[model samples]
Target: MRRHELPRTHAAGRTYLVTGSTSGIGYFIAEQLARTGAHVILTARTAGKAELAQRAIRHSWPQAQLSTLSLDLADLSSVRAAAGHLATFADRLDGVVLNAGVLAQQTRRETVDGHELVYGTNHLGHFAFAAQIYPLLQNTLDSRIVTMSSYAARWATLDLTDLESSRAPYRGFATYKRSKLAQTIFAFELDRRLRRGQSSVSSLLAHPGGALDALSPKRPPMPVATTAQVLRARPLSLIAQGKDKAAWSAVRAVLDPQAHGGQLWGPRFLRSKGEPRQERPTAAMTDRVVAEQLWQLSEDATGVKWPSLSQPRRL
Candidate 1:
């Protein structure tokens, strides 16, 4: 687990898609998979960003097989277009790391479809994208989707009536936590449906404790850092680790063949930093009633359905 050493997955035909791969934990997830000789598709809001990420990965491992797609989750049209484009090339998807999303923003925002920006991008946008790509996953046995959630979600209070934060007061951090909770609920619900349908596809969740860029190793594709800046963040290293270490759970969720659906994997200690391990999900994430409510809300918002589910009405 050193910076220079790469884990050997020995995956050649395995195809994965990592959203928000331009930087942070997502970038490292793509990098990890690429190093193992896996085929990866790095997604970004624009074709240029995606291309740059592809080049960045290849620059390190010349044998890396990578592709790029332009996907703007804030725009429903863009999600549809990206899914369509992906279907043309990716006949099957072994796994997907749902990592693209905005963190806490200073002010409330809205997506192109008029939904609250944070919930729209982090939850609903991924909801649609996951639904659209469900067919590809179905085509591949044992395919899975790994959702990236946050420890902060433990602080959220779900008010389904004001799910969009339109009527409720919006504290940036609190609202962001709520969005993570929604997605976590969505992941569990998808796992339940996958089970009911008896499909081999799985849905799992993974989260980082607290990721610090300064503690992360510097690479040419990412932003440059000053020595002073690295030292300034050293005190925080006591609790948090770099995005490289934070990405371990996600990579395990993606590559572990023995992994089952409905399992939560995360950093080993205090939900912060260590090896990836199976962990219990918070009660809110596993509640069936709340998950069903969010699932309905997602379907209504996204106009996408899981083709595998024959009874999408009740489940």
Candidate 2:
């Protein structure tokens, strides 16, 4: 299928939570779900953005079932508060799109939690949110948690000793790559744990090929003309697709009935943009040792324990 012709999956009556849904790919994901008659819980960093998103969706689908939550993935407290608010909702979540993230910051910074801003917001924040709201996911049958990764993950070299980038010199791109790698690792590890516990909730990973925009304020500015020219000369630029096309991998990962735990989905033509399809993750992303270590580190860093699945709950 062409990029604009991506197929839709059945989602009527199901409730989905999509972080950073006020604009860009996350907005489209929420809109698509709402279009299919699903009740969409849209999250934003502020109430204003959330209101705009809701208005946009309502403009397109007057009767769309929608609710908004204020969440800042950079703030662990915000994530926890959002989870607490989410628990008050009347319906069980059918899925969650862990799509909030930062591309890269111009300078090294720290979150309020005192970790590298990029790593903390892109990976750790989502880690805590997913873990906290996991029981709600578990309560739903065949529910999914889709963690958004990036093409940069393959270039990352994770050092277990310095997951927070404390010991190493900070390079913006390197830090961002490691964060994406962490996301993929967490997704796969969560899948493994869920399987071990005999739970039905699936954990999936996806990357937007070259999609440029997301709702988060932390997104880096577009490259300058000279930089764009240099990038266009590189082979990777050939696969650079629009944001809408880039979101397909994530949309498919969430709604495709055939999609399963531990699968990595992205554009069909490797890094180049095309129809979404199952793709192999990097060796680092699939390494059991790396995944386990990252999981432990996430639990330690976030102070959120993974829920026990000894007794799987049916929706």
Candidate 3:
């Protein structure tokens, strides 16, 4: 079953929020969701980009129910404010996608909150933002939360002693990989928490392989600038799977009722080309005990308590 080829069902009254929707894989996801008649909130750091994306969608689907929301994932305060504002406009949220992330950057940098740029935007900011929208997701029927992880995550490992990577030597690619691994692990942890609380929402994890698109503004700088420029100039869309194909992995995990929770999906070809396939997390991701500890550590680092999961569910 292909993602775009999946059954076309109307999501008339349903609402979805897609971060980093202004460009790349996230943009395509938002466009497809809008086509299905979802009240889609397309988010980006700048209002200009957000509006441009909204307009682009409307141009294609005049009746597309899309709105722009500004959110800077690199900054925790910005994330909190954006999530807060979203709550006021929507009564319930059916889908939430953490699609924004930094790619390969050459330099080591920190966000406004003094956290590493890659980890801050890709993990901490999203981790906290999702927690803030706890209530809205709870109110929906069979809600879904999708977080994007990359195949590069295979190389990522958790450094308990240096979770922030401040103590250890920093390599650009290594940092990105580590953050992606955290994203997958965090998804599993979120699912566990939701189930424990008896919440209907299912937390899902996915990734777009070497798809041709940017993620978020806070994306890591390209480690190999020359190679990137060469590839771009050559218009190498032929070399990798299109962004649309890559995004299917996410669409399947989010919409397919039969799909399992806490699984990763990627393309079959090298770097995820062709149709998406099921991918298991590394042994590190399956370690429930470690996942729990990591979840706690993330909360502590971000200073965001998951209010929705604070109390046990009363049957």
Tens digit of per-residue lDDT, candidate 3, span 1-315: 653374355788889999998877887788778877889998888877877787777777789998777799999899889888998888878889899999766777899999888988899999999989877887786888999988888877887666666854578888888898888889988888777877778888888887754212212221123555545635555546656667777776766667765667777666556666778678877678878888888899889988865333321
Clashing pairs in 3: 102-219, 102-220, 103-220, 104-221, 104-222, 105-220, 105-221, 105-222
- Our model 1 lands, by Cα RMSD against the true structure, at 3.3
Order the candidate numbers by TM-score, best to worst. Answer: 1, 2, 3
Q: Each model's RMSD to truth, in Å?
A: 3.3, 4.4, 4.8
Candidate 3 residue 115 Cα shift, in angstroms, is 0.8
TM-score of each: 0.94, 0.89, 0.88
How far residue 154's Cα lies from its native spot in candidate 1, in Å, is 1.5
Global local distance difference test of model 2: 0.82
Ranked candidates, highest lDDT first = 1, 2, 3
lDDT of 3: 0.78
**Candidate 1 weakest lDDT stretch, 10 residues:** 306-315
lDDT tens readout by residue for model 1, 1-315: 443233446989889999889888899899999888889999988777677777777788789999888899999999999999999998779899999888987788999999989999999999999999888888787788999988888878778988788864677777799999998999999999888888878899999787888888876765755888789889988878888889888888888776788988888768888877888877888899998988888899888775765322210
Which candidate comes out best when scored by TM-score? 1
Which candidate, 1 or 3, has the higher TM-score?
Answer: 1
By TM-score, the better pick of 2 and 3 is: 2
Tell me the TM-score of model 2.
Answer: 0.89
lDDT of 2 by residue, 1-315 (tens): 455565666677799999988877787778778877889999999887887788777877788999988899888999899999999974698899999888777678899889889999989999999988988989999899999888889889888888777754667888899999898888888888889998989999888877543211222122123555445545544656656577788888888888899999888876657788888887888899988888888889889888896577987
